[model samples]
Each structure stands twice: as structure tokens, then as C-alpha cells.
Target: MNNFQQTARVGLFFILGLALTWVTFETLRGGKVFKDQGYNLIAGFTTLKELKDGDEVRMAGVKIGEVERTRLAGRRAEAVLRIDHRVRIKSDAAATIVMAGLIGTNYISIDLGTDAAPDLPDGAEIKTQATADLNSVMSQIGDLGKKLETAIGDLSGALSGGKDGKTGIIAKVDLLITENRENIGKATANLQEITAKVNKGEGTLGRLINDPKLHDELVTTLDEIKKGAGEAKNFIANAQKIVDQVKAGQGAIGALVFDQKAGEDVKASIANLRAVSDKIARGEGTLGKLLSDESLFRDAQSIMKKADRALDGLDDTGPITAVGVVYQGLF
Candidate 1:
């Protein structure tokens, strides 16, 4: 019976040892004893940000794989991701080291690439993009705080004074106010007096504001001026229309100014008038001879004298004798 008890105790101890050994193995191997049936993808980053083996690899927040291992390859750190055979990652899928939370572990997060993109092959390098981690953000915030502190210090110094015994803006402004106090008071008094006069209808501005008759006259004058301006605008528009018509060959002036055929005709008429004037001046035509010949004028005067003699003879003779007398006189 003692031998039986010893054997039972040994068996129990052996079982416990096996259990302990199994738990330790599972912990070290990330709760998986058998190798994962998946392809490997290399993801490179400048810094992994505490990412390690067995960290989850997720595509759009869904777990698709695990980071099989991490290592340094030359200048950059890399993680070998074991993606499930059932899941396919596109060639354009980018990997980023994302923090689960402020206190939680880091993981590899991927984006869903375009559907038309080809699938990534085994052992291919997955593209990695840098992200602003909490540490970097905190560092930038600290820098901003320092800059703000510096700016505040400068503003305070400028407003109060420098340490070099020079007067500050506030002090200088106060001194200026003290020196100009009397002048400022005089200006303010003048302004108040003017405003009082204006309110009481004592000046032009006062009348313009307080006297209804004057206001009506001013409005009438403004209306007249507006009417005159409208008339001027209409005049200008009509003038512009006339000018446009001239440019477009649409009226008599337009034809004379813009029509090539009409202008050519005008030039030809002027040339013909010049030629006729030249001929007249040179006594080449019958009208020019009548105007220029002295002989023609003398002949006309002689004929007038002979006709006068014949008329004088007819007054002194009988009808038959008068005819003979007029013929002899005219001849």
C-alpha cells in the first residue's frame, strides 16, 4: 500500500511539471506552440516605437496577422510579419506602427489598398509610413511652450521697460500725454463748442442739419445735379453711338469716313473738279474764253452802241424809211 501511494505521488508531480512546462512554452511563444501557416512580409521603419514579436498586425483595425519577429537591417529596423494564408495584402498596402493606447502595446497597422492593386508576394517588403508618436507630440508641445514663454517675456519687457535704463512705451506715452494736456484740452473744448453751435442751427453745418427749408433746398439742388448728370451721360452715350455708327459704315458720315468705295468716289470727284478749274483758269473752254477774252467784251459793247443808234433813227423816221435807216445804222 505504501508503494502504491509513492507511485501515485510521483505521477501527480510529473503531471504538474508537464503543465508548468507547457504554460512557460506557450507564454514564450506567444500562446502558440505550432508555427503559423502564413507568408512573411518585411516591414521597415526608422524606429519601431517599442513594437516587438507577437504584436498584432491589423488591416483596417481587424487582426490579420502577427509580427513574427523584429530585427535591425543595416540603417533601419524591420519587422517580419506573418500574415494568415486566408488574408491577402495588396502590394500598395502601407504599414505603420500604431499605439493601441497610452498604456497599451504597439502594433502594426495597415491600410486597405486599392482593390485593383496586385497582391503582395511572400517575403516582400511592405511599405512603411512614419507617424507622430506620443513622445514626438509631447516634444513638439514642449517646444511650443518654450516659444510662448519667450514671446511673453519679450512682450512684458517691452511694455514695462528694458533693463538698460531706457524709457518704456507706457512711460513715454504717459510723458507725451502730460506735455500735451493743455493743447488736448483746448482742442476738446473747440470741438464741443463747434458741436453745440451745430446743434443750435448757428452755422452752415447747423442750418444744413437743423433747418428743414435749407435741407429741402439742398435736396432740390442735389436732384438738379443728378438730373444734369443723367443728361450728360445720355449725351455721351449718344455721341458714342454716333462714333460707333461712323466706324461701322452705317450713316452718311459713316459712309464718307469708313466706306472705301465712297471715299474713292469722293477723291475722283475732287480730282475732276480740280481739272475743270485748271482748264477754266487757262481759257481752254468756251465759258473760260467768255470770262477771259478782251475781244469778246469789246464786240458786245460795239453791238450795244449800234443797237442804240438804230433805235434813235426809228424815233425820227416813218416805218418804211425807219427800217432803211436802222439797217444802215446797224451795218
Candidate 2:
């Protein structure tokens, strides 16, 4: 009976252990019993971060598969992830580590590329991305600590003036205040006085702000100015009437601007001058005859050309040769 009791107790303990192991396996597998239902892809990262075996492989927000293995490939740590065969990953799929829960294990996360992209092949390398975690965050905070130390050092130096016998920020501020104290007081007093005057009403500005009489005066002045403008416009209208009379030839200026007979006379004189110019151009008068006489023009051209040739040869011909040419021409 003692042997039987002992045997029963051992079996019970073994059963409990099996049950616990199954439950642990189920939890790690993310409630999936068969792991071969997914397609496999590989990715590489420099560090594992906190990822583990049996971590869920999620695409977007949906659970797709499980992580198969994590191993060192050369200098990079690589992970083999199995995705649901039904969930087709594109050729450009990216994977990163993500926390499964607040305190749960980290999982492999995938970003699905656009539908227009080609499907990724089995065993293809899914691009891996580094995810920030506690270690990176702590490293960043350490750098921040150093920056904080530098900022504090600079602030201390500025406040205490670089550990030397120089005036500090407080001393400079004090000196500035001392130098400008009287001017600051005067400015403050002036501001106070002006504010008081504005409140009580005194100058033209005060009248514009606080006096009904000033408002009335401004309105009256505007009305008077408007009346004067109306009178000026009336005067301009009468003057325009006089100008219209002048344009109608009822005055000296009118005759100058609008006399039709004078215009006709000017047109006749212009016509006569144009006729004379035409006669000259056609060689029908003295000027035209002179211009159109070709033999006379040729003679003059020959004389001018000879004179030009003589002048061009002057330096080489000598003064005696020039005198001989003038004498021969005279003969």
C-alpha cells in the first residue's frame, strides 16, 4: 500500500509537469500548435535586441506567423521568420523587432509593401531595421547627460566669469542698472505724466480723444471744406464754359484754334511748297536740271577725284611736285 501510494504520487507529479510544459509551449507559440502553416523568410540585424524563439511574426497589425530561429551570420545577427502562406509578403518587405505586450516578449514585425509590388519568394532576405529599445534609449540618455553637463558648465562659467577675477553676469546687470537708473526713472515719470494727462484731457490729442467740442469742430470744418470744394467745382465749370466759347471761335483763342479759312490757307501753302519740292526732284526747275545733268555731274566728279588723289599723294610727291600740279592745272 505504501508502494502504491508512492507510485500514484509520482504519476500525479509527472502529469502536472507535462501540463505546465504544454501550457508554456502553447503560450510561446502564440496559441498555435502547427508552425508549418506559414512561409519562411530571413532577415539580418546587428543585435537581437530582446527577440526570442517562438515570437509572433506580425504584418501591420495582424498575426501572421512565428519566428523560427535567430543565429549569427558573419558579423550580423539573422532571424528566420515564418509568415502565413496566405499573407503574401512583397519583395521589399521590411522586418523589425516589436514588443508583444507591455511586459511580454519581443516579436518580429513586418511591413507589407504595396499590392502592385511582386510577391517575395521563399527564403528571400527580408530587409531588417533596428528598433530603439531600453539599451539605445539609455545610451541616448547618457549623451543627454553629457550635454547637460556641458550646458551647466557653460552656465556656471557665464554666471561666475570663468573662475577668474572678472565681473560676472550679476555684476554686469548691476552696472547697467546703475548707469541707466536716472534715465529709466525719467522715462517712467514721463510715461506716468502722459498717461495722467490723457486721462484728464489737456492737449490737441486729448481734445481729439476726450472733447465733444473738438468732434463738433472737426465735423464743421469738414462741412466747410466740402462747401468750398463745391464752390471751386462751380468756378471750374464756369471757366470751362469760357474755354468752350474760345474753342467755338467766339474769342481770340477760339479763332486761333478753330478758324477753318486759316486752315485752308495753310493747306494751300503746304501744297505749293510740296509742288516746288516735286519740281526740284524731277529736274523740271533749276535745282532738278542741275542734279539730273549727267555730263556736268561727271565733270565735277572727275575734278573732285583728281583733287582727292593729289591730296593723298601729297606726302610722297613733295611740295615742289604739288606746286607743279597746281601750276599745270591753272594752265
Candidate 3:
């Protein structure tokens, strides 16, 4: 090959090597070329749930880092996680392994504590949250089944093996069934007789079910009651309507209740009557003067007397003489 061809082949191989390295790094470790921000937290639990190294550590749904190691620490299991230093986590943050999706791979989930508190120090042990362990759940279910079996066995023993050998409640019940066989047959026949009577509409209760007239009467009575109730409702509604009219000043009672014009007319009439009363008290107008003045009363009395005397004289005097007496009396 020529020198240019050799240089070209070397460049292509170098590019291939770089691409392969990138692919390999991505396969080995999750995430892109640029490292994400995170923080490391420790959680100790009895079971690690098969959490493996290189599992993603997430905080508030954002990828932070990977699990570095897991091992038995003292009486508890510990998982070492390498997290991005740039990620902010609280001292109370929780680290847990959670499944990604249903039937999917598991990932490390870090619950970011409330942002109100200060960030946790590097490699600091954080707060832990315990979820239901699969083995523990199975054990509890098995214990529940055992308790149920114990309860059932106790009940069976109590029923079958009693303190009394022969006179237990179940044994007494069986003896009673055996002794009352013929009496039970007679009682059963009596029950059948009663049922037949009821089915044939022979008893009062049966007639209540089978009689059409009583049913029709009941229906009619209900209809009448409904009609009465409707009428009562209509009457109440009309009364309410009348009350509303009175409130709105639409009728005679309404005018008395809310009519400003009627009130003003009444006030005007009262004022006129008061003026007339005051006039009477002061003896001002003709009628008021007539009512208040004693002199006018005396004058009226004298005029009535003169008329009576003149009428009495006319009974005795002739027509010409009566006229002469009246003319003289006037003069």
C-alpha cells in the first residue's frame, strides 16, 4: 500500500477504537458520556433484595449514581453506593431499591428529603425506610394460616369433645331429633293444613292477599287521600301566594300592609281632621263656631221657642189674626 492509503486506514481504525470504547463504557455503566450529579447515602436492611453493583441510584426520578458494593455488615446488610458529588441530598434522605416497571429490572431509588434542610455530608449514613420484604410477607401469611387452623381445630374440639361425656348440646340436639320423629310428623301435617288454608284464601290474612274488592277499596282510599293532600297543598300554595301579594301591596290587605299612597292618604285625612278639631277648639269656621259658641246655641234655642209659640197661637187664632200677631211680634 502507498503512504496515503496507510494513513487513511490508521485514521479509520482509530475512529473505530474510540466508538467501541464509548459503546463499552455505556454498556458497563448506565447513562451518557457526561456524568450526572448525585450524592452517596447508606441504607442498612436485613434483606438487600438482590440489589447488584452498577444499579442506578435515583433521587426524585433523576439518575444519580450506581451501587458500588453490597455485603453483610455486622447483623445487617449494607450496600455501598457511589453517587455524583454535585447532587444535593438532605441528611434525612432515604435510599432504597425499587423495581423500574412491572416485570422490569430493579434500580436504586433515593428519596430526596425535604429541601428545607441542609445537604447531607459525603458518605454519610442516611435515614432508611423499610418496605415489605417478600420472605417476611410469606412468613406472615403462613402464620395467619396456622392461626386459622388453630381456631378451626379449637372449634372442632369444643363441638366434638365436650366436658360432659354424653349430655352436650350437640348430643342433646341429636337425641331430640330422634325422639320427636312422630310428633314432628303430626306438627308438620298441622303446618301443611294451615298453609293450605292460607293459600286457598280461607283466613283473614289470605283474603287480604286474594280479595280484589279490598284491594280496590284500598287503592280508591289512597287515591282520595292523595287528592285531599293535593288540595291541601294547593290551598297552602294559594295562601302563600296571597301572603306574597300582601307583601307586594297588590290587594286590599296588601294596600293596608305596604301601600305608601294609602298611608299618605290616611295621614292627609288625619291632618285635615286635626285641623278641623283645632278649628272647633278655637271656634274658627262656621261649623266649628256653631259647635264651640254657647251664644249661637242659645240663639238656636230662642228661635225654636218662637216657632213653637207661633205654631201654638195659630192653633187658637184665625189665619188673619195669626198673621197680624206674627207681624207685631216681628216688629
Q: Using TM-score as the measure, which candidate wins?
A: 1
Candidate 2 local lDDT, 181-215, one digit each (tens): 99999999999998788778887777777899899
Task: For each of the candidates, give the backbone clash count.
Answer: 0, 1, 2
**Model 3 Cα shift for residue 44 (angstroms):** 3.8
Candidate 1 lDDT by residue in tens digits, 1-331: 6999999999999999999999788767653676668899999999998898889999999999888889999999999998988999999989999999898589999999999999999999998999999998999999999999999988888876877524777777787889999999999999999999999999999999999999999999999999999999999999999999998999999999988999999999999999988888999798788789989889889988988988887887868788787778767
Per-model CA lDDT versus the true structure: 0.90, 0.82, 0.80
Off by over 4 Å in 3: 1-39, 46-49, 60-62, 71-76, 99-106, 155-174, 215-331
TM agreement with the true structure for every prediction: 0.70, 0.53, 0.50
Off by over 4 Å in 1: 1-36, 152-161, 164-167, 258-268, 271-331
Give the top-scoring candidate (lDDT): 1
Q: Could you arrange the candidates by TM-score from highest to lowest? A: 1, 2, 3
Tens digits of per-residue lDDT, candidate 3, 1-331, equal 9999999999999999999999888767654466555555676877778677678788888977788667789999887777888777787778777867555466778887887888877677767666765667789999999999999978776666566645555776777889998999999999999888878988886776789887788889999999999999999999999999999889888996698889889889999999989988888999888998889999888877887788778778878788876765444
Prediction 1 TM-score vs. true: 0.70
